[model samples]
Target: MQVQPLDIVVVGGGAFGAASALELAERGHHVTVLDRTASPHPDASSTDISKMIRMDYGADVFYHELAEASLDVWEAWNADWPRALYHPEGFLVLSAREAEPGSFEFESERVLRERGYDPQHFDAEHLRSVWPVWNADRYPEGYVSPRGGWAESGAVVARLLKLGRGAGAGFVAGSFASLLEDGSRVSGVRYVAEDKSVRTLKADRVIVATGAWTPVLLPWLSDVLKPVAQPVVHYGVDDASRWQSPVFPPFAADMAGSGWYGFPALDDGRIKLGHHADGCVVDPEHRGTVSEDHLDLARVFLAESLPELADAPVVGTRVCLYSDSFDGDLWIGEDPERSGLIVAAGGSGHGFKFTPMIGKLVADTIERRENPWLHRFAWRSLAEPRQEAARMQH
Candidate 1:
């Protein structure tokens, strides 16, 4: 932990950037964070009403352990933070059929039991008896862990921004135009200021946490880091309490199969659902839009999974973007080609939950400390994107 304070500039004040700035600044480093818009930018992926926070990674023990550790932090944050950002409503995962080898539910149950956690397993009869809202016949097998639930993602990001600013981290509003380099070393950044005026920021080191825009901003990474657009739907209902009730926790129905998962109703009477399958390629410039087919899929999922929600009116939709890597691992650590530059993008789809813990890991990498998780996140060449089977991504 003993290191000289270095002037650092972090691009993108979303979850990753804000957390990094907070951690770095707390370590007595002069940190400046720049973003194209506000801290909880409406366009940013992490700005959301709710996001799942769970330790279920199927057979991947690394993330399970990391998630459990982060859960402890989330519990502390729940007590310390003024607002309710973390929710321990628990997470329920269902499968279309009985447990089979290599299936998401099966593997998750296997791993959880191995770790000595008592996950409640339900059969068709039990599921129907306990959760009458669900069409238990279709999803006859499932499990619910009291350990996992959802997070108020946007509020958490805003809270981190406030903490960073309060801890002496400078904040700037701008679009990343280019990086200021001294020969092969990155010195700072040149960006379009909030007033639309071009400005240059100088720093000893720069960390790029620009999420989906990383590929477009640094084209060399396009082959390694890809940005894709996924669909999420929010439905309007008359009895909000029915949908937002304590019994209705965040659950996935055939997630790795149908890629269907949903959050309980928000305070605004809207129930959110998302598909976690491979999203379509998108350009962040013009941006992606939700198509009729995507909405139709949402309809079909509701009809099959939650019959009561089948006829509910569609309130809103989002073409959410994911920074996917060729191998589904995060892209972090210093760029081998560029000195004084660190790359921390590629959230895939499950990165938001790690906001409470990623900062320390990212800070460790930035400070040149040897971290056990570095090898998986380091820059590498993957011919084709192979999303890990351990995590449920439909």
Candidate 2:
């Protein structure tokens, strides 16, 4: 059989890769997106039930800017379709005595302020007075951003996948085996389709947005991308009305202490809980179960920090993967060692909030274009290193 040449071949159907395909396809590129499974399918980060979409980047100037820009894009899309892609419920964070006021958590507030955003601060006394459901006596302070909120991650991915199809981008269900290369230049991608047929498609450019499975596809960058497992559990409370407090924002309890974060109750009466920046290192293909100890930690956090939901039942629990970088930043751009291959992986746990902007970033990088945020997250930079938990403050 004769091989057909394409303009670009993207090796992941996740949000980043699908966004890249849509952006380029709209620009008239013959794009083909190859993925291990059809999009909107489970097992991919982009299809998770929920994802945070907010502008509080916590002192990362580059991400702050991207978040701001992504908000505009999300708004534009919402105006076009009127779906629940971005919900502006605001974010509420309670800090403890152990945390400093102007640390990472505080710095994020500062960034938002510098960008002309309005975020309210509440001392422990004020927090308890405003929200009787919370036991703010345990915390020193709380921060509330009326602008921060949640987004339906899986729905957004599904919508984009549908848009990509309407835009003429081909979606092939397959697992990326490896890249077909000629010397240092990437020529195409080798993958096995859902039918178990091995096929190779040639392209002018190849983008690897495989998320946690990125290292498995390109073993040469094993040291750069490490997959970590984090515990995530969903709870159902008896009275969802307790979450209807006016001051309640998608909140974090230990941002002042242990870095725990969670969302407000969804319309479905479930509130999610998980800690940030503290996941166990594991392989993407072989993730393990969430240990009993981990569940105990979450239970204790909810019980000790949130009195209203302390007795809530653990309705659901699952393990999520975080593609971590040493410095907790993402790896985005063309690979240094290979030509025609661009990477946009290792988002740590913060990539979701920047989906629209990250899509633009990946699209721009793949086209050899200039993007402002690229200066902070270069394709090949060794200076910015990832250090293990220095402080648990969110």
CA lDDT scores, all candidates in order = 0.85, 0.75
Residue runs of model 2 more than 4 Å from their true location after superposition? 1-6, 98-101, 244-247, 381-394
Task: Tell me the spans in candidate 1 whose CA falls farther than 4 Å from its real position.
Answer: 383-389
Q: Which candidate leads the pack in lDDT? A: 1
For model 2, state the Cα shift of residue 366 in Å. Answer: 2.1
lDDT of 1: 0.85
**lDDT of each residue in 1-394, candidate 1, tens digit only:** 6899999999998888888999999989999999987788998888887889988888788778778888998999899998778989988888898879777788878888888899999888988887778888798789997688999898999999999999999988899999998889999999999888999999988999989889999898998888889888889988778876466788988887788899898877899999998787788765667889989888988898789999999999888888888777778888888898898888888888878777887789878888777677887776545556365652
Pairs of colliding residues, candidate 1? 326-385
Which number leads on TM-score? 1
Model 2 lDDT-worst window of ten: 385-394
Quote the lDDT for 52 in model 1: 91
